[model samples]
Target: MTLEIVVHRPSVSGGGRRVTVGGVDFGLARGDGDLVEFLRRAGLDDADQLVSGDSPIIQWRGGRAHEYGAAGG
Candidate 1:
């Protein structure tokens, strides 16, 4: 089965990010050190340096990045 992960980097919230995998929202905030650490253990990279124009980089079973970007206005 293929896993889908959505990484949201909202401009206003800083690093209060959200990652959704297979419709399950990982309501993980940067403030929650334990949760972030847990996700790190699960192979998620640190997202503190994200910006508005950044793309949602994804990693999969084959270890390749699926570069997804927002639609141009």
Candidate 2:
């Protein structure tokens, strides 16, 4: 299983590269380690369960879809 990390930068006001995980949106200033830690804390490190077709536990929060688990795990 492989984890895909996508970095997005918007060309608009208040637009910047951010990492969203488990319904939480974090700025790039937070650092990569922080992002990884956030994912780990969200039970996303379980590669077995993630790759078993039960991945991307999705939940609606703040009018957006927050996905958990590994991508293509």
Candidate 3:
């Protein structure tokens, strides 16, 4: 299955990283494996990590959040 991961810029106030799968925002931690697993269970793959910055939001098409670099930095 195909999934879209929307990674937003990290915020100190909110102090959190939000992950969006298929248009659904799944609030998650930087290294929350459970979140990736949840996405996999929901029909994703690989799921290693997701990379993002405080620039324009990035949209990646893949199976898991790992191969994408979802780990908040």
Candidate 4:
């Protein structure tokens, strides 16, 4: 199964942007660096998998979703 990275822009309270992996909110991100850190902490290797356009869509197998990436499996 493919996972979708849903990003919520920073709110008016000055809270950093937030991202969710596979519908689960990971946490807030101040910028690209913070986003990457969150993704890594969530066990994602290639960040391209989170790209919805241009990037190749990864096909899912019978295991965890994050295991797949643009390279396909």
Q: Return the top candidate by TM-score.
A: 4
lDDT of 4 by residue, 1-73 (tens): 6777655644445555557777778886555566667667767786544433324443222322322222223
Candidate 3 CA-lDDT value = 0.48
For candidate 3, lDDT tens digit of each residue in 1-73? 4466565444444444556777786775454564565456555555533332322223533324333243333
- Give the Cα-based TM-score of candidate 3 against the true structure: 0.46
The deviation in Å at residue 22 for candidate 2 is 5.8
Candidate 2 lDDT for residue 44: 72
User: Compared with the true structure, what per-residue lDDT tens digits does model 2 show for residues 1-73?
Assistant: 4444333333233322355554365444133344445456545775344333435542222222223222222
Q: How far is candidate 3 from the true structure (C-alpha RMSD, Å)?
A: 8.1
Sorted by lDDT (best first), the order is 4, 3, 1, 2
| Local lDDT at 2 for model 2 | 40
State the C-alpha lDDT per candidate. Answer: 0.41, 0.39, 0.48, 0.53
Task: Write out the backbone clash pairs for model 2.
Answer: none
Better of 3 and 4 by lDDT: 4
Q: For candidate 4, what's the RMSD? A: 11.8
Consecutive 10-residue window with the lowest summed lDDT within model 3? 49-58
Candidate 3: regions farther than 4 A off: 32-35, 49-73
Clashes (candidate 1): 0
